[model samples]
Target chain A: MNDLPHGLLTPQILVELDVLERNIERVARTVSAKGLALRPHAKTHKMHEIAGRQLEAGAVGLTVATIGEALTFALHGVGDLFVAYPLWISDAQAKRIRELLSYVKLSLGTDSIAAVQQLARQLADKKDKLGLMIEIDSGHHRSGVLPDEALDVARAAREAGLNVIGIFTFPGHSYAPGKPQEVTDQEQHALGEAARLLRADGFELKRISGGSTPTAELADNSLLTEVRPGVYVFGDAQQFELGRCQWENIALSVASTVISRHEGDAQNPRRIVLDAGSKILGSDRPGWATGFGRILENPDARISAISEHHATVLWPEGQPLPAYGEQLRVIPNHVCVAVNLVDQVSVVRDGEVIEHWDVAARGLNF
Target chain B: MNDLPHGLLTPQILVELDVLERNIERVARTVSAKGLALRPHAKTHKMHEIAGRQLEAGAVGLTVATIGEALTFALHGVGDLFVAYPLWISDAQAKRIRELLSYVKLSLGTDSIAAVQQLARQLADKKDKLGLMIEIDSGHHRSGVLPDEALDVARAAREAGLNVIGIFTFPGHSYAPGKPQEVTDQEQHALGEAARLLRADGFELKRISGGSTPTAELADNSLLTEVRPGVYVFGDAQQFELGRCQWENIALSVASTVISRHEGDAQNPRRIVLDAGSKILGSDRPGWATGFGRILENPDARISAISEHHATVLWPEGQPLPAYGEQLRVIPNHVCVAVNLVDQVSVVRDGEVIEHWDVAARGLNF
Candidate 1:
């Protein structure tokens, strides 16, 4: 970054080394203290360096949201991976999974018996087996089956020669402020009911994987054998707003250059525009979000509006507005989406570039 | 696409070749009929195939939003290109532009005198000069100077040894429903006033580029010399909702496989989950957007919710919900964003995959 000119790449993703290491070690130590298997979701950083660092820091495995992402990490030598998405195993995906089985320890998530049946049909001839985890719907209501239906899916997986390990749930509702405890309770309740039902059905379930970024710190390890949190590796504005982390905990931000400024009205005399638009910071503002994103340097200045390639920040009156050619760090509302939008992120330490990690699984959405 | 299994590697981007060609030809013909130059914005599809075809259809050039995008197209033999963005060129970027100028006819958008001065300092030593377009603030206040400021920016560009070509504006406010005419008029008024001002400054502007997808068809020809519409070749739900294009005019969509289903409540019984999520279709819903996206086969079925890897479509009651493993076509809220989220798009004609176009400039935000 120092070698390049001042405003070359106007908006680029950057990771502070100290913040990143601290964030990773904090979660690793917490999960260790709780005696829970730490499986940092590879879906967040999507970089092999981060995954390698996570595993080196005592992460048992790396969890991912898709087989494609899992394959990317597996190819990069992440030996154990759990695809925590309810996948409908198509023939090609089944073939890919079978190929992956030869390289690493693989686990799949299933929410329906139909997907399990299809998996059974496709992988019946494969000699290797992949672990299956039935996704239990806690409070997100986006996916997953009820606890009662977990056994049925597990039964189908067992019948299809797949190993039913345990169950998992995403307490996604925890993303909102003041919902962490309620969402964690919901996660434990759902997983507990599923585990009990599975045990009653005579299934010896092992690895119970669950937890989102918001619920990772609050989830009880007694209920979940393993925890998967993606965004904790790169704290975002949402996490800060939800009180999951402090301002210093935000490890990732879009380094944008101020390109223009204009006074729309007399009262709004401090509107500074930056090149970090929705294309760089991403457009993932929840209804309760203050604005599109917040400036790390000027926390009070909010990105009042955004176009595809422009962030209009209505700077607060007290703080001096950024002039042309000035660089500012923008904390996006959702770091995961912002990370996925970029090809690489520059890892910095003490204001110096250390490494540029490629977002390897950036567009691997299949 | 037909050669693949029922549910493999979806939710994949699928483009109907016939529809894509027709849409392209329709816009090209419309622009030609008005004796206007067609420089389709490559930021939408980011495919060399589409840009090549647009040029083949009598397009004067291709318009892009970044220098990185310009380099990608220039390398692919796009001889003429325009970066329709207010760029704060770093030394590295200025060098990149210098390199790009060696390959093609390059013009850039600039709204500020500082950027003009920087361009002059960077390109002063170079023998070859690049065209400059002074961006006028239309209805969108994202970037661009007001009409009155265009001459100052143009004067700075001329002084800096840059050839001032024309004025341009992005009437982005036309995106909302019932705002096309107002936005188009805004575009004309802004560009007309800027052109008049620049002409009065003794500069005969040549290429007045303007128009976005919503205001493309409604724009007055005499007011602007060229039209740069990104999403016209692949209409999205936003265009459809704004009456800019009909449902049939939508040439691109995500081919998603139904992975799960559930009866949520007594009233909302039909819910089919598809593999297409925000990762594939992109998360770009505005406040007024209808659901996340609409299903093509079942238009009434709105994707009520979306997760990172799952789209839950709340199928309207009285219609039989799609079974598991069924394929559904989803029209995303914005085509440009959705296109950027994928690696490649499968081109289809007669229910068969004809070719695959790489999103070559997918993440070229720099």
Candidate 2:
């Protein structure tokens, strides 16, 4: 552990190569064993290095949240990409998407007739080059239409001369405690129903993508042709608390230092301040989440509050508080958002930093 | 408004130059009228263009949250910079800080004896060149020491041959509902008591910094020599909801397009998905916040849920839902985090793109 340089900056993301590789291999192995394809979401790491590793581990392609992210990985030499979002493309973006199709197989999600028709009009002659996935609402009612409503979007795509590849659903509700298995069942049911309806309408469904980090392992291979689990590679505090992964399975952590310490008083509790906070770790706390984040060195130490650059940690009772300037690894509550906050991440193996990977698609939200 | 380019990409930040200038000038006038120095925290905008405007508006200096942010502005010709955080500097950072002091009037915050002693040891002969401000906890209870405890930290700085120039506190509790005036009073009391104690110990203090966006206007200018207000430059949903600023006072908003529309059913309510989400808007909803964020055009519309690249918005009861591909301006819950999420912001005047300002100090959270 001493191999991590002293005087190294705080709030720097360190990706443990050994653990990261193991995470990638394990996910790939599980998917392959079930005869299901894996298209690991690149939105979590957003680095070509991690995407390359996933592809090397037999992933069929990369899954991204936006067309910009797809273009990034495509430019990085990834030949196949799926933009798993209901993209509302502008004419300029359509031109870029057309250019991207020249070098890669591109697909995007759609849940509305207006969006599909708009995409068809924007793509014009290039419509055939891109594929479309009908998004279905599977308990997580953020985006996506109901299962029965998938046929309307698919029909719209067909009428507009666009290719309807398959359907997908995000089991996001699994993020809550004791919901993984239940949400997985909902995901499978939604995708299965959408596929049944689309197939009955003589649509050839080649892909059925589903799964978030929490429900990926529990995904039914018969229903989901591929899994797009983004956060499984990093395994954040949310996943750890949800029992989706063990603490040892976490591969990425922010190296932070205790900047100030305060002893308990009547009004104030015993606490220490860490350099890592919302700006780096990200402010993403689900109502069910225990706190803002977790201290990897001591999980019992709770992050009571987080400001832009200050994470106030309540030290575990009876445990010696970290001295001022003492380093601690902080696991963000949501790894995806935290990773997006940084431009690059340090890749380490057995405490030695092997290389640094640029978060090539860091803010490609468009 | 149609001057905004057609087919512009979604999830893009638009900084309205007219509103931005007015906001800056208003704050400058307020501080000038109160006879208080205005050191606008550049952490909110992080762009040199905005900092230049603030300085031109008669700000005493630029306040940053980290040393890296200070270095960015310092390199950009911002001669006066204060890193208002209890920075526990490493040896390499100390060297960089010393190099910065050669050109910029650099001051940092400290709340611990160990941190002051460490800085003294790191700087060695260069210790006299740097100034320290003892941080006091008015009510934020994050990083600062208590009002009375500020003297112990100051004594340590005085004993270590470091310059203790003044004291500072962040009345962050003002962010809550109905708490701005109360927090401002607490801030004044804490700063007054800390200054009194430090002055009683025969230490001459020059600076008494206090204020956050919520409490900056309510600050007692008689007690605080200078006030640091960051989020006022580009008002966000938080400030607007807290009744600190009017809706039209907001200077920055994300341009987003409706991607999907869902009519209400027995199971789900009517909603539409936007291209902007947590990845661009940032996930920062205070417990007292109304919702995740707000649609600038329709304040009644609520961003019910936000994923990586999808914002699920609940359209108002009587208001017509935006058509698929229709664009709208979205105000993020926290403008500071939202600005940091993007690499560059498009400056607009009368809807025409004026310039693209780089977020030079973005993600420089050391």
**Local lDDT at B196 for model 1:** 86
In Å, residue A195's CA in model 1 sits off its true spot by 2.1
Interface RMSD of each: 2.2, 1.0
Root-mean-square deviation per candidate: 2.4, 1.3
Candidate 1 chain A — worst ten consecutive residues by lDDT sum? Answer: A1-10
Question: Which regions of candidate 1 fall more than 4 Å away from where they truly are?
Answer: A1-8, A126-128, A158-161, A266-270, B1-7, B126-128, B266-269
Each candidate's fnat, listed in order, reads 0.58, 0.82
Best by lDDT: 2
The positional error of residue B192 in candidate 1, measured at the CA in angstroms, is 2.1
Per-candidate interface DockQ score = 0.58, 0.83
Best by DockQ: 2
Per-residue lDDT tens digits for candidate 1, residues A1-366, read: 222224436688889878889999999999899889999988888999899889999999899988789889989899999988888777778878888888898888889989888888888876246788899988677778988889898888777777888888888778887899888888889899999999998898897878888888887678789999989888999888888888988889888888887766652345888888877777777878899888888778888788777889988876666777888888999888889888889888878777888999997887
Model 2 lDDT at residue B304: 86
